[model samples]
Target: MRILILTHRVPFPQNGGYPIVVGNTIKGLVSMGHEVSLISINVKKHSGRQHERDDLLNKISYTEYGIDTHISVLEVFSNLFTRNPYNINKYYDAGFEKLVLQNIKDNHYDVVQLEGLFVGPYVAAIRKNTTAKLIYRAHNIEHQVWHRLAHQKNDPFKKWYLNLLARRVKKYELELLNQFDGIAVFTGEDKNAMESFGAEIPLCVVPIGVDMGKYQPEPDKTECPSLFFLGSLDWLPNREGIEWFIENFHKEIVDGDLKVKFYVAGNSIPEDFDEYDVPDKVFIQGEVDDALEFVNSKSIMIVPLLSGGGMRVKIVEGMAMKKCIISTTIGAEGINFAHGDNIIIANNAGEFYDALKRCIADEWYCREIGENARKLVEQEHDVNKVTRDLVAFYQSVI
Candidate 1:
């Protein structure tokens, strides 16, 4: 099968969530003897280094068009008058659309998969240009993220604006539903969300998969009674989650009897992050060289996400690395895990604190949880197995 994947950014480097999933999917499909081509709109932030981009080019057929997605005050104000979603509208480039059309006309593809909702605008062009089965691989229900963000906002005006943005994005999302031949979501929850929004088209769950071979568990290196949170801080949900955790539970944990430490590591750590008067035990190590190494060093992985949609790839990676994970219900969504068996689900600060306490007090319990997590990943998220299922779905859609 010949597959074409369209994404808003280059999936090389795999430094962040979006790239990791997209890059792994491409690799998995190629390993299964399927021809894969990628058309990506590269922004400055996600363009990655020259060597990283070269590495990707060596592996698969990829074409990237550079675009400026920087948000400006003028664009924001102007978008208020239009019903179109500012976030999705900014990604619509005439040149990129022309390039997509030309690619479709030149190469006969069995399936053209839009990697996320941002690329949904290009569906009409692809539908008209080719007879290929169009698949929308939804990473999340885009508008729900905003709706959750809106609910979290305290200011009335900000909340109103966020709700408005969510509505506009929702309208655009629902409008694009039937335009695709099939829809692939990261979770069953996402599929249900789409169905409730009147998406009558074929929908299937395709959770994010990782190459387990790349992740080797180093249990000996694990630091007992230590906790760490890893993710891109530039993303609202991650930053919000970390902030919420610190504001609500950090002091309690620090002042408690246990001498446990919390380490925060990720890309794009905010400038004002240091301004917070956090305890000395809470170490902020922003943007480490090797993510797996960082995960291996930690005893317990914490995901205190208050609001977000879709699956958290970091959770899957941590599980693959055999780290005991304690996350909120929202954080662990889309994953097939029992609350106490494979993972620890904590919805509020009290629950998170209790879970952290339990993990710190008993080293053996943490090890047991970590082992179960690794087993879950092996059984459910192996990249080869996931790609085979994806290919079967493509065949059914075709």
Candidate 2:
């Protein structure tokens, strides 16, 4: 199978869950004797410089399009006049579309795997030019963000603007679904969400995979009183999740007569969230090199995620580290586990506070839940098995 992979984010570093998943899938396909060619956008570098995908894909070939040193005034003006969300506007460049069309016509790829809706426009361009199987991997329903933003919107004009943007994007997303052979979502929840939207294509659920070898539980995890929350800061849901935790749960556990510290680790802390103003119990560690290393010293992993879609890779990563997970029902999106079995789930502030306190008080119970969670991850979300299943799905679709 000659598979052509497309994604908005560069699959280098394998840090953020999405890019890492795509990068790992490509490697898996290649290892399984399939030809994998990737057409990815070069992610904007922070210091106005060039970026490198990690050594895992050092030999993995790809074509990088839409690599601007920085966003220009012209692009901003165009996006503003065009009414496109700034999120999608940056990816709407000519080079990405051109390369996609060229690959479809010249390469005769077996399957064109699009990483997210951001690249949906290319599916039609490819289908129009060549005979290829198109599959869109919905990382999460994009509209969920709009739903959250709509709630977070305080201003009338701002709320109206976000509602309008969400409406437009949803239409684009629905139209894009008509152009694909199938839709692969990261979680069962996302699969159901797409179905609810009336997506007629083959709907499949494939959860995120974790490198169990690196994320295995620690032998000394029984000796910490810390909690962790990790995600890519650029994601609005992550920001919203953390903000909700701060405003709602920070005191429930820390100030509610429980002796615990919250360690929030991720990239790009909104400048306003600087430490000078953060709650005393919350430690905002911006962008650590390795989240596991920072979290290894914690007693339990916390996912007060109020809103988001897809399986939380951070949850699996923490479970991989052999730590007990305490998350809201919304936090534990994709990974299906019943209460008191593999994880401890709480939906509101009172429940969340009680769960954390109870887990902390019962050392034996915490260990049991943590061990069970790790076992579930190894059995279900291991990369080796996950990649095998993904390859089989691709083969079937092709």
Q: Highest TM-score: give the candidate number.
A: 1
lDDT by residue (1-398, candidate 2, tens digit) is: 88888988676666677776887677667667778888888766633444464665655567766565357778755665664566565576777788778767788788888898777656656778877788888888887867667767679987776677677678777767767888888887788778888888888887777667677546574456666777877887777777877787665555577677777777777766664244657677777876667767777777877666777777877777778888888778888776888899988878877887787678788778888888888888887778787767776777
- What TM-score quantifies how close candidate 1 is to the native fold? 0.96
Assess the local accuracy of residue 362 in candidate 1 as a C-alpha lDDT between 0 and 100.
91
The TM-scores of all predictions, comma-separated, are 0.96, 0.89
Query: What is the Å distance of residue 342 in model 2 from its true position?
Result: 1.3
**Among all candidates shown, the one with the greatest lDDT:** 1
| CA deviation > 4 Å runs, candidate 1 | 48-56, 253-258, 276-280
- Total backbone collisions for each predicted model: 0, 2
Error of 1 at 390 (Å): 0.6
Worst 10 residues of 2 by lDDT: 46-55
